[model samples]
Target: MGAAVGAIVIGASAGALDALSVILPALPEGFSLPVIVVVHIPPDKRSVLAELFQAKCRVPVREAEDKEPIVGGTVYFAPPDYHLLVEADKHLSLSSDEPVLFSRPSIDVLFESAADAYGPALIAIVLTGANHDGAKGMRAVVDAGGSGIVQSPEGAFATAMPEAAIAMCPTASVLSLSAIAAYLQEV
Candidate 1:
């Protein structure tokens, strides 16, 4: 066994729901890392992502609340219109801050903050998306000595985000969606 991973952060955009359906259901109930997800979604609409994933995933899944503590064996989703941040104390904080790259709940915000909080204990993953939103964030994770994974562009529904991340963080592992799921299960 290796040192326990403290947290996992995932970012996705276009075609995210379908991708999540595959990955989320594969996570085992005993997973020991706090999993945080940021998927591009319409900010104005109420999100049911938590409810949907909870139904399929054996592990507990819910929308992240402001000031909540991050817990292992749980999956937390950034709310539609707020930036989700992780503190050094391992508590979550929500910010109504301006959107980044036109996304309110930017993947960069969550990934960067989690990387800062968890340092080498963090694992960051970038999935399919139309833009390069998560590229710099993944770089931050790697710079902080955290590991990074990017879905292979060929395996993504939208390749731009993964491609950008791979370009920016050349050492990051490039895995297919199924491979990523398997890796998570093993973790």
Candidate 2:
């Protein structure tokens, strides 16, 4: 009865990044779902994720600005050195608060905030990474009545992240990158 899908949040790590470039293009054009991405970038560096995705995805991609409104058909990246959060009204909030799991732009921060703001209307996808950053957050999504998905461990360049997510939540779907894009279209 609530929103079918208010947003999609993706958490990615170091490996399998090249494959993501391939997977992003397969998403439906002009999709109404807003996408928020949390990627591990070095603390002092600037993110090229927006620029990289801009060329590959049909949807507009930009770094999340403080207090920016969350909009559909757009992809917002968590800027390096800050944790990006979603507000109750579906706007963005950026914080330089203490890092979790040694990550500034933490996947858990975004996922937890999204769970609080959107509740049942969110979809969380955890991709390849060396750490277990997204596992707790994916569990938060499931607890908030949202869907939780992870890249299949066998398909990932780094299996730790997906494996952790699966360990935390059994119902989390393990999907290939292409399958994830397709499922997003259907969801």
Report, for every candidate in turn, its global Cα lDDT versus the true structure.
Answer: 0.93, 0.89
For candidate 1, write residues 24-79 as lDDT tens digits: 99998788888999999998889999999999999999999999999898999999
Model 2 CA lDDT for position 171 = 95
Q: How far is candidate 1 from the true structure (C-alpha RMSD, Å)?
A: 1.2
CA RMSD, predictions in order:
1.2, 1.5
Quality of model 2 by C-alpha lDDT: 0.89
- Compared with the true structure, the alpha-carbon lDDT of candidate 1 equals 0.93
Best TM-score among the predictions, by candidate number: 1
TM-score of each: 0.98, 0.96
